[model samples]
Target: MITGELKNKIDALWDMFAAGGLVNPLEVIEQITYLMFIRDLDDTDNVRAKESVMLGIPYQSIGDYKERPNMIGMYKTALPKDVAEKMRELLQWYSKQEKNLTTLAEFHVRYEIIHPFQDGNGRTGRMILFREALKSADVDPFIIQDDNRSSYIEGLKEYREEQKTDKLVSLMQQETVDYYQQCSYFME
Candidate 1:
């Protein structure tokens, strides 16, 4: 769970990116993910170092940075134009849909189609889907487990090719039902 302070930090980070002329929403997401990844790596390294000290073992930190030339240029070139506009349009359309699993599935598929970043699109889109589900539908978000990768990819491909959302919707619904059933069982 993101604490309010962390959320505020993230918002500040986003604002920093905007101030740095990253107006595209997809670029913003990608850049934010990069920053988050860096922070997580450092945090992981710190934890591992502490654990190693506790266990009296040598530890190699993951914070070894290799400077790459033209990285900024590469990123600038990688971000396509008008991503913010596209996202705004998508949000406007989504706001009209009934808040349900089906709508969530459709939103995820369309978000993939947008492909806003050079990488991390899938992870970011899934996060957005989960967040939206919890906020709009009042349900616990379901994970697309590793075992279901192929089916998930197939569903995405089918949607891209045929504009059909049934497979994805069914998959999401089943996952959600399974999650709730498990929760109920645990509660009982």
Candidate 2:
């Protein structure tokens, strides 16, 4: 869970990107991920520096500065304008939906269709799914474990090929129920 301070920091970073004219959602997501990575790296470096001092070892910082390249241009050139426009439309539609499992499933499928990033689209989409579920639904968010990869893929394929969300919805619902049940058993 992101603490209030970290969430505020992320929101500020997001606002900075938006103010800098990043209108593309994918670019925003990527830039936020980069900012989060940098923040985490800085935190880790601080801990390591302390450890090194305690151990009487020289600390090698990972905080080597690098020039920030024109990633906007690169991302703009990589993602076609039409695709970005379509993603914007999809996001707008998503914003209007009542938050629920069905809407989440639809959003996931549509996001996959957009496939905004060169890689990590599926992972990013699932992250969004889990976040949305946690914020809006009555169920606990569940991870799609490695053992369930085949069924998950099949569910996605079913949605893509046949416009069916039943499989995916069922898979997610079952996972949520099973996770809560396991938690309950452990608590007992």
Whole-model Cα lDDT of every candidate shown, in order = 0.66, 0.67
Candidate 2: where are CA atoms >4 Å away? 1-79, 137-139, 181-188
Q: 9-111, model 2: which lDDT tens digit per residue?
A: 9668767878999866545654555566558667877898899999998766653321222122123212334556777898999999877788888888777
State the lDDT of candidate 1 residue by residue for 1-188, as single tens digits: 46699889967876898899987654554455457756765676688889999999866555222122112211221125555567788899998988887778888888777666544466667767656765663545665655787778877877777888889887787777765665453233
Task: Please identify model 1 stretches exceeding 4 Å from their true place.
Answer: 1-79, 138-140, 181-188
TM-score of each: 0.55, 0.55
Residue 47 CA displacement from its true place in model 1, Å: 14
Which candidate leads the pack in lDDT?
2
